[model samples]
Target: MSLHADAWSTLASWRPDYYTQEALRQAFLGYLAARPDACQRSCAAGHITASALVFDAGGEHLLLTLHPRVGKWVQLGGHCEPSDSTLAGAALREATEESGIADLRIDPVPVHVDVHPITCSLGVPTRHFDVRFAVRAPRGAHPVRSAESLDLRWWPVDALPDEDGELDMMLAVLR
Candidate 1:
């Protein structure tokens, strides 16, 4: 199946909260319909990004990265590469690459969807229609910071920084 078809299927299966159900579904369907290159970075109108909210084996803590450019602690994710077959695969690949933990297991279902504007170093401001999934890290896993992040740390799920909206989104999905 095409990546776009996979994204459509994934979104169709997601059961988002009442607050986001209609908006998320509409945003995803619109993305698929309006942009043929929705999976690629060049889609200036907006593009689909995949992210993983990673928790430890026992679910006590969440792994977050301080994004260098964005200057905020956020979930592990990035642009969808051509090699990724599904949004879940893109999220898992991003988590593995950003956290340096190879044994992460990602739930195939999307837990949340968000549309937010961002301006990368290369282009004009664009929106990231992010499909987020939950990932459980290996027991006793140790994560090393990648070049994409300024720092990497495991924050207790209950003690996450309140300033980061991404944390709130994660908490909502995990609950």
Candidate 2:
């Protein structure tokens, strides 16, 4: 199946843990149905981006990147590429590429979905329909910074550099 079709299928059957998440899932599916190019960056309006929130093996800390574009500490994720076969693959790929950590494992099911506007590399204002998934890094894994981030490190979940409601919501639902 195509990436777009795969995303549709994934969301179509997805069972969000919260009411708000369920709403986002429904809205995202509607958006995809209306915009066939929603999975590609060339859409010129908005596109689906995949991300992973990487938690330590013991779940004590989560890895975050100081994103150069957003200038804030956030999860590791980015725009979907043509090489990615599914949204989950895109999230895992971004996490691996940005974290530079080996033996990372990603949960196929999404943890959250967010829609935010930004002036992307396309040089135009657009919305990023971000799909977030939970990932776990190997014990004693070390991360190397990538060009996409100004800094990358593991932060205690209770003392994050920035407030991430999405993470909180996911944690509440998962735990």
Candidate 3:
């Protein structure tokens, strides 16, 4: 199947309750179904993407990307391209590309999957069905900023800045 077609099929196959809650899942699905363009581009067009939450041993330190757009400390991730065969692979690719980490190991199970509306720099509305994975970086591996981020750092999980609801949710799931 084509990338777009596969995305649409994946979205259609998701049970409403399979997401966080019945109401939330239904609402999101309903919104997607309402907009044929969004549905088509998001699912069928292969615009869906994934991310990773890389944690240090003991899970006390969290790896975060200094997003160039938002200028906030956030997880490493980006759009899923055709090269990525699965959501996990896409997320891992983003993690490696953004962080410059070569030996990263991502947990197969998704820690969480969040779908939300995003307006990029061009002010175009797009949906992000972020399949968040848990990953571990080799000890002493320090990530350098690529074009996607301004910096990369390991922050104490408890000392994260108070911003971005998605980051909070990601941390909660990691805990």
Tell me model 3's lDDT, rounded to 2 decimals. 0.67
Q: Encode model 1's per-residue lDDT on 80-114: one tens digit a residue.
A: 98888899999999999999997899999888888
Candidate ranking (lDDT, best to worst) = 2, 1, 3
Clashing pairs in 2: none
Return model 2's CA RMSD, one decimal: 1.3
Ranking by TM-score: 2, 1, 3
Q: What lDDT score goes with residue 163 in model 2?
A: 62
* Model 3: per-residue Cα lDDT over 1-175, one tens digit each: 5544444555455543234634544554555456444423345422355788987755777789887777678888877675655666777888888888788898765666677667654357766655578888887887888887788888887887647577776667556
Best by lDDT: 2
TM-score of each: 0.95, 0.95, 0.74
Q: Residue 155 in model 1: shift from native, Å? A: 0.1
**lDDT of each prediction vs. the true structure?**
0.87, 0.90, 0.67
Question: Model 3: what TM-score?
Answer: 0.74
Candidate 3, RMSD to the unseen true structure: 4.2
Candidate 2 residue lDDT tens string, 36-141: 9999998888999999999999989999999888888898999999998899999999999999998899888888888999998899999999988899999999
Off by over 4 Å in 2: 164-166
